[model samples]
Target: MGLRGRWYRGGTSKCWLFDSKDVALHAPTREEIPALLSAAFGAADARQLDGVGGGTSTTSKAAVIWATPDADADLDYLFAQVGIGDPTVELGSNCGNCATAIALFAVQTGIVAAEDGMTKVRMRHITSGAVLSGTVPTPGGHIPKSGLARVPGSNAAGVPVNLSFHGPWGQNTGALLPTGNAVDQLQVNGRTLRATMVDAGAPAVLIPAEEAGVDLSSMADNLSGSLPTLIAARASAGLAMGLRNPEDPPQNAVPKVGVVAPAGDYIAADGTTISADSHDVRVRMLSMLAPHPAIGLTSAVAVALAASVQSSVVADAAGQAPLPGTGAPRMLRVGTPAGVIITEIISDEKGMVSEVALHRAARHIATADIDVAQAAELSA
Candidate 1:
């Protein structure tokens, strides 16, 4: 039998969306899920030439949505990171970019009724128990394709979809400071480097690019040489964050690694110049061991949280710019290789991170069916 799926461009990332019912029909047991996803994505091949995967980590994601019993949430969204060069699928984390597209999928698939103007869809991530609210513009019961919101890596303009991650701290590792310290001296490759491991929207290890002997402005230029060090640092930090153990092989998706530095002149992926004065901090986050073309939404949230802390590496890289007035939310502009992404961070009376919000755009790309037999044969 064929499984129904939809392709969506959510922010800078793309993913394949499937109804939970359809997924259950295909893979009845959890053990079979990885094989099923690998077959569908044409894994075990670096290029992913036989499947829909775009041959990159950012495009090799999948999401399954289903109705939930909780009254606060309209549906449950499960995100899966499908491997391209290996036959592995990691469901330990959530994809903030794909989370924004779930709202549109719910409305288009009749899981939720869409009203005129903007519709708010509540989602619960099954893996981390994190709740996110996605506000999508639905004019006349149809998602509008045009709007003012523009993401850094995408070429098209669309309505700004506002996503608010509620209670985002400790979504995966169970503690905001998973290592119990704002900063830790990590021993990597015979040298100790200052690192901050924070769990906000996601668990991320932030390290200074200079400490690693890499140029932040030209991260992509040295990605091949720097990945080994970054991956080693990530694995070590993952163990400290309690996301991995010495007995278990490192899962490259979780506890993302970000190399940070003060804003500087850099060349964007589009060949445009990003002025140092335009952005507060420069960052390059990795997805599945490769430098992401753009920053992930959840990573941006983690960066905002890390930057607010006084002694963290991200804060030091951001310099002494004052955050917004205490009572209101503040927008922090983050510079990535693609461009600048604006993230809003709010703090409580106790000065702890209260909420993080950002704007993303989603577009309905295509609706299709996957032949399970064909996928399985390709894997074989």
Candidate 2:
């Protein structure tokens, strides 16, 4: 029998949940994990109709979890990104939304005390061995089932989630800029382009849409409809970030693309309209696969850092407004399709970034078990 799941979402993302017992994972090596995850998601077509995948990279996710042996951590959380139009499942990255689900899952499962005070959860990301600390709201001695907080893309009101990661810069790669610079000029389409490359929550290439010649300020609806030029821009960005192999465009990976501009009026994905003056910078976060209407946790972190620094895309809009230099905690409010995402970053004067904090203002919907043992049977 198939395991039960909820395609719930937080901060503009969703995932397929499998109870720890329902799924079984046995990979002799890390390289084998992606296929295993794709199978668990039961992806038969590009849409993954046979499984819980929602057909988009944001919704196409799988989480394997179970109680852990550590006292500080309640459960072990593993996340996988099954490609939208492809069979490759990437396990090298961490999903902040999935990470949020893990913390909420713990309280809903009674793995931890859901008191009125903040519920602290320490989770060891199996892929990275990185310990993540998360705090979710508990109301009336229970995990708050709902709240009124709303994000750019989410419709429901529930207990907003707060997730924090220490040393998020270069999370998978090991350097903030990864290429050792805040800004890099790349040649694509026979034109020289400037991009701010940062590896905060994920590898991202930030460009000013206006400077790139995309008049986002005048676009009636966030520039809907994809063009070859846009796709080429994104593809070229991925290669410049060193995430894609020059020899194999067919086997390329997602490096994420975003265009920033001064704030202006626009419609959010949820149909809620916003004025550019409502945000510090008009920001759009692109997933490796497509343009996300909103932003990702790590990308938001990178935007916050870039906004603080001078000469970068974000900096061009916000000026050289100095943030707390190096190790000083600061917040960056990004205007997106969902509304605004405020991310915090801790940095030092040495230009080294250490931690990224994401404050999501969305209510916790609910949590259910997926029977991990059952999900594993679908693994190839």
Q: In lDDT terms, which candidate is top? A: 1
lDDT of 1 by residue, 228-266 (tens): 889989888988899987999988898889889988888
- Tell me the spans in candidate 1 whose CA falls farther than 4 Å from its real position: 140-142, 145-148, 219-222, 320-325, 374-376
- Give the lDDT of residue 267 in candidate 2: 65
After superposition of all CA atoms, the RMSD between model 2 and the true structure is 4.0
* Per-candidate alpha-carbon RMSD to the true structure: 2.0, 4.0
Residue 3 lDDT in candidate 2: 49
- Top TM-score model: 1
TM-score of each: 0.94, 0.82
For residues 57-158, write the lDDT of model 2, one tens digit per residue. Answer: 787876777687565567777777787656677665677777776677667667677877788777777765566667887756766666676665676565
